[model samples]
Target: MASPPPPTSSAPTGFSLRKIAIPAFGPSLLFGIGEGAILPIVPLTARDLGASVSMAALMVALISIGSLLNNIPASLITMRWGERWAIVVAGIWSGLGMSLCVLTSHLGLFATGCLMVGMSQAVYNLARQSYMTEAVPITYRARALSTLGGVMRIGMFIGPFLAAAAVHAFGLQAAYVIGIIGVLGAAVVGARIPDLPVPPHPAGQDAPATPTLVSTLRDHRRVFLTIGVGVVLVSAVRASRQAVIPLWAEHLALAPAVASLIYGLAGGIDMLVFYPAGKVMDYKGRRWVAVPSMLIMGVAMLLMPLTTGFATLLMAALAIGFGNGIGSGMIMTLGADHSPRHGRAHFLGVWRLMSDIGSSSGPALLSLLAASLSLALGIAATGLIALVAAAVLASSIPTRRTGAGGAHEK
Candidate 1:
């Protein structure tokens, strides 16, 4: 397949996205909430089922494993069924998974349900991103995708609170019930999305053959190897941020309630920066946000081990949050920018795979280092990785500036 043309200044003026907002982003919010509600309880459920601490950790890891294994297949499914239907199917599948979690007491069955939900998430996320890449104009792409990210954050932020309420009212299993409701609601919302129009060919012109996954990967290997490495490290840092704050809070002997409040505040900060981050990426080019975001997170991670008090730890956690917040939607925006028109889904699958690998690996690396050495060393190493990611991004991202209507000019 031919390379994509240089970025153009032809995006239509006043191309408002208000019409497609709900259909584009609504299901994601519901899905995020459901997934978030269940995430905090998965390990607890495993322990209740008689699994050891290590085994319970493994059970939580299964979700990432499931997502990693399904990325390519999810793309194939999206290609065959289209994005809207793919989302609907994924949501239904997630609902089924949640039902299993709610009904089953067996450990193996519960693990299967977790795996299924993760697999469904892979499909649901890819389909939504693919849909938006095509539906939104390039000039507004960053804002659109960033808002989508923010929406998911909002849902996730709301989810745990809802789960807590439900757990207080009912029992532990009530969280999974909430998940079932959320996924089913997402499915209902997904069903309402209007079908995306297929781009028409010019009269009397032969249509180009659609690229397969293998061909897509082969063609995009350069970008994958370069910016892709940066993507992996970026995901690694983001994932490690989740682990570092809690571990440090524990290390400092902070109260559980205090730790939760600090983490919650960090999440709130993270949620607030998505729109501004997108604006920077769209108007100033990706590097302006990507490089500095990683740098801040990297510095925060390096400083975390030195904190002996709650106040200090809280500051570090918030720094990490602010850094990560400003990088919202960056990975998806990069994927959208580089994807070929003919096999976009296939390319995005590879992109998401790299991201998932980093997400899964980050926590594992932390566990290994913390177990073998010390927690401080592990966090410091993660900080080093984040710094490396920043350097990689600085060198790899295009230096072109985005002008009016998203035009790229060197």
Candidate 2:
């Protein structure tokens, strides 16, 4: 770990105080904004190209695969080439790839572009995070990360509305074009940010890579299993909820806009409540927060098919966000916290891989389960799985809070 700084309160919080923070967070806002600008049109885009429901869903599926493949490569590139350059390169690739997406009528080609976006997103995020941890006071680390979540929520808020308007007006292709532009803008911003200078390696004996991916798996097996199971369970819940909610709403003849509004509310709550959630983790305990949060997610799944209008659906969204805010956030921080020295890149890579795997399979699993069964039942099953995983995760994590409020090194 990098040498610790003085107390956080002594650090600046004004403009000059945030020099590293702003530069570090700016790219995320750009990517988040880009996400907002395009994510709404995926299904419409596929439909416009004459694809089946499953084929249209490929847009989301491929992104997970892309993220899964890129996790290790992204972290590896950061270790070798440094943060600023790798992130900018990722931005450029995502922009260029998405721009080409406007020309493709094939669902496969469209999905491929989405994959590149995930790959680029992985690298940019990995590099940006490494920079944040190294440069900031450890006490402020969770706050710094929470700030990004808020910014992304802001982007998500604006993005879907913009995508809806753009797709409704010009076309889905135009929406993608706008997304590419936003990604490119982020790349330009990243290019201007300077690379952090590496702190010198300790003197005496040197070795090659520590906790190589294999060793990391060996050492952290139980922790990974617990976390991985939680991830897949939640991912499945999210997938089922997202898939069924719109269809359910439509069956009642509700406007599609109401469904979009539901997601918007979830994003808003996630951003708004994250700081307090982090504070709870710091002052009280993370496991306490995480376990109940998982339970809440399960409850939200049960609540989904019951709501139709925007307002009621918003309640479900809040439940989903509340659960994710505590559980997933803590899980990610724990992944970072548990990583051995000189092995952060690999361990984080593994973390990202697990997330991608869960998300990739999540929708497909729901689709298969709901094929013969009711979507509501599939969703309830998701909740049951979450409760099981939460039970396991609660047992695994230490009860008391640690570093930076729960971000302490092992």
Candidate 3:
């Protein structure tokens, strides 16, 4: 394949939604549906296996843990196979993992299966993002990526409903089976579709040395420590919001059905904002989207503990969902913005690792704080941390776009 032309200011004149939607969107949605279906059930499945609440939480944690462990390897795989094949492999791997979860009676095996699902998901996610980096024009980058985030959210929004039907007809294990079917369907779509061209290393020059994870970190140390740290905090806040919401519902004595409905409503609100956010990012700047989004989330978290009933909690949930919606593809967008055209897969892998770490840490931090003090204190502390992260981000990420992938920026 030819090397992509150097960054152009005039926006690829003919760019449209179809260019991105055809191959990437379908697979991403399906993959997300499968993941969403399984996520809520993992803990329940663990509990049924006689695990304690804490242990069940641990089992669920395995998903992020697996992603953290596999991010670098998955990036390497993408580098080797290119985006298309990496996606194909991720779907197959996820299916295998779902099957293991469905078939296993042993808790250990089930956790292993969940871990596999996470690993596959990480690979799948990176491939799609990398493909977009290579394929989409500069002007549409944020909108395209945010739309990708929107599609995933759509699937996630739909998934539990599907899981409910499957479980109602069969059992809890049926959800995993549904997840497997989703994965398989996504795999088929990804396999059949044509992939965007990946540019080859420049003509006549030796390929650039493949940077190891350590070197990538060292090389990008400044961004990672500054703006990157804010992204990590964003991840932490997002994860903590997910963890805290359900626990808050439980604390308020809401029934499972009510809690689910409330949470789903929040998700609905979240799904509504993607396009506008993307538009803002593309036109105004990333910080505009990033700052308000985090501020909203921080305020929501701070207000959460003050809620005395389902109605108040619902308000907080809506705020969180709104915040999350506006920041739909924040991390992916930032990573893509910073990644060079050359050796992008490795850089993205490192980026994913940072995100995965934040994701894992959020829940861990919540659990620790709640255990030592109170859930309210823990929740409030998380809110304060998010507020701080927003400040960091405001001061960090470059204020001007230097074309697609921020190719010209340091």
Candidate 4:
């Protein structure tokens, strides 16, 4: 809850906020647009492209696989290449890969194309996170990330509706066209972002230091594991809810469009609160809100099956949004707080990998469970998992050692 300590060092290259912010903003915006365009069409696209339901699901899964590959590399690249170049290069790769999805008509080829996109996303996300962490002041790191997250959610809000409209009007091709443009827009922004100086290396070790990357990661095993487990728990629950909500909507007999729209409102609330929620995290310590927020999220999920109307769904979404918004920002700040003075990139790389794994796996696991046990039972299990994860988070706030930064120190 303390204000962030002021910037110890100046921003790299002393770029004005405008110069840096716009560049960062561009990738997020384009990602939103592309994401928006893809969401409505993903299932239909898969079927049309000749994928089985399971294979179609794999199309989504492939992206997670790519994220898995890039999680650590993204951090490594930003440490060496400078944030701007790494992000731009990653954006270009992302654009090219997503565009490839449009060109392929074969199911096998389409799946491969999707895999490329996933990989590109991995690199792009890592570059983006590392870049923000390295290029900006530490005090603003969570805020900055929060702002971008807001932008992405906004894109999500619009992307699906727009993509759906595009598909309705011009068929599936329009969605890809828009996606290509969105990615290109992201590339442009990344391209314009100027590079920051590499983190200082140990004396006389002229090559940009990566030996430390390995060692730093190895030494902080517990911190990273804790972060990883937290990320996986949250992401899986988040994904499970998203996967089942539509089915829930269908059970209540809402039209497909109506179902998506219902989910969209939650995303909208999520976007709306993100900036202020992040500022709150900045103003308050991570646990002041994060611990309680997560428990509430679990409670929200526990109540999910109790409602059958859109209004109830909306309430669930709003509560979940609030809880998650605070939780994510806090966790991110926690990652920063815990990273060794010289090992932030390494720590963050691991932290992000945990998120990718969680986000990637959560939905699939839920979907499978739902098929066997029914949606309510599956969600109930998720709710229980949420309760356990929340309890873990609430209890896991580490007591500070002597000389710890800020108030945690004795």
Candidate 5:
């Protein structure tokens, strides 16, 4: 085995959100708007092109599948091209994909376009997450990351409203154009922003000695198999919430415009808790936030099928938002926590690959269950899985908390 490398240099001193995070915020916001604007409408668009609800959901699932497939490539790109360039390129790519979606009239073509957007999302997100992990001080890791997640939520809160307006003015297909605009705008912003300085490599490590992906994955196999699995299930429940809610709204015969509006409103609740959740995780422990977030989401999904009207469903959506919002950045945070500092990009790539697997499969699983049994039963089954995930996380994660109020991980 190679001798342990010398201690790495510290992150830049003093944490200022304005100094560190603000530069990246604009691109994050714009990209989130682009994605959020399109996501709620993807299933609706598929339905318009002669798809059953299950098939429509599957079309939406393609985004995650594309993301899953692209994780390693995304990581490789980030490692070689650097974060700034990768993000700018990703935005341009996503904009092109959205343009395809806007121009296409067929469901298959539209789904293909969305697949490209998903691939772009994976690259863009990996760059941003890797940047955050490298730049921010460990003590403030959760807060910084959570704030980043909150910014995305803010954009998401705004996106559905814009989508509703676009649908009203043009048509469901025209709504995709909004995403194109947002993505191009993001690319412009990202291009203008400077790349943050990453922490210096450990001494004795040559600048040219970047580690290979295969070796990194092999080194981190234990964490990847155990804690990583729980993170994937957590991601599944999160992705399911996104996929299930709008579909559930459609199932209840709510107007597409109205459904988008309610989903947007729930996102408002989601944006509200980012900082507090980060604070809890930093001080109280990961389990404090992780367990309750999963439990709340699981219970809300269980009750989702029982809702007969907009009001009851709206309550369920809000509950889900509460759960999701509190856990904003949780998966990424966990990945950062476990990743080796030396080969972080490769480890994160595999880490994200696992989560994206859950993200991709969650919708397919839900759709399959809906087809095999009933829609309600499918949702309930996800709820059960989520509860089991909560148990797995609570049992597996160490009870360590950092900073002044830090406690042992549990």
Candidate 6:
């Protein structure tokens, strides 16, 4: 197949990300903050609403389910309305969802609201990624997407503290208020950004007919089956990291506060590495970061089984975080790389669906193993998955290099 054309930009010489940063990434930050603020409180509120423990856990899972269900629909919406408006609509939709959570005491109504928020998240996330894929030059693509990832992480990090303060000052429902503010804020920001002009076809040449999601998937089956499977494993390992640290910490009998501190420390390290990782991907290659990231995480997971104390657990957690952090934009970047210009949104929707599948399944796989066999074995299974992810990525990622001008050549 012919190489994809280099991305075109209308910006003058010496383009800087600052010009598009707020317009491109601002809404994501606001949306993330709201989601984060409400996330920790979801189960607590569900319990207060009289849900059983398992049912409350299901309530939390609804968000991922909602996201998974809406991926294709979200892509359709973005394709129809364009990225900016899609984001605006999604933000407003999420705000309304949060409103339901805040206003309704009915358990069913509350669950519906959680589902709405999750669905909106699917649209919101896909829109931003699609926008960045089109708007950012390929040379800077990794860095731009990494920055977007980092920005969201910062919002999530800030959110719980805001939730804590709000809950303390008001009540449990007050946390939803923060979420309401966040989504609405994102909507407003999204509405204000100028719409990106549709890229023109060559003179005398007509634009190609838009492709359907089914057709796009059929055409890209090879990529989806190969690199896409790798993506699933990558996501699975990453999601398992969240469960492993806390579960293992509990097993080791560490204090809850100490566990939280260690988790927070690992998160801090995770947040710090995004830019450097992206830079390496842009300058060297995707494999430079992707392979090592999985390898490190795999090694960390394997080591986690042996940690018997706080210090050792901390070391394991930090390794997991670092491994995850360095690959912050790996999946998004890969999706963008493989996405056809004609059906980019549709392709991305499917790509994210694959990712969400891994995210939803990873913890369940760990739990199943833990329940049926042993915790150590469950964690080790994830480690094995991570190692497999590394091998798949190393072998499958094309060796094409992106030049300073954003041109790619094998």
Question: What stretches of model 2 exceed 4 Å from their correct place?
Answer: 1-17, 49-53, 104-109, 164-171, 203-211, 238-240, 251-255, 303-314, 325-328, 403-410
User: Against the correct fold, how does model 1 do in TM-score?
Assistant: 0.96
Candidate 5, superposed: residue stretches over 4 Å from native: 1-13, 40-59, 103-112, 166-177, 198-209, 243-265, 303-315, 405-410
Model 3 per-residue lDDT tens digits across residues 273-382 = 99999878877678889999999999999999999989999999999999999999889988888876767888899888888888888878998999999999999999
Every model's TM-score? 0.96, 0.83, 0.92, 0.85, 0.84, 0.96
The candidate with the higher lDDT, 2 or 5, is: 5
lDDT of each: 0.88, 0.67, 0.86, 0.68, 0.82, 0.90
Q: Which one is best on lDDT?
A: 6
lDDT of 3 at 36: 85
lDDT of 4 by residue, 290-367 (tens): 566667778887788787888897787678777766554555566665665455666677877887777767776677
Would you list the clashing residue pairs of candidate 5?
A: 398-409, 398-410, 399-408, 399-409, 399-410, 400-408, 400-409
Give the worst 10-residue stretch by lDDT in candidate 5: 1-10
| Model 1 per-residue lDDT at 349 | 96
> lDDT per residue, candidate 2, 255-326, as tens digits?
778766666566556666766665565455556566787788877877776776667766777788767655
| CA lDDT for candidate 4 | 0.68
lDDT for 167 (candidate 6): 99
Q: How close is candidate 3 to the true structure, as a TM-score?
A: 0.92
lDDT of 1 by residue, 19-65 (tens): 77788888878988898899889999999999999989888888888
lDDT of 2: 0.67
lDDT per residue for candidate 5 within 261-314, as digits (tens), equals 788778778889989999888777678888899999999999999999899999
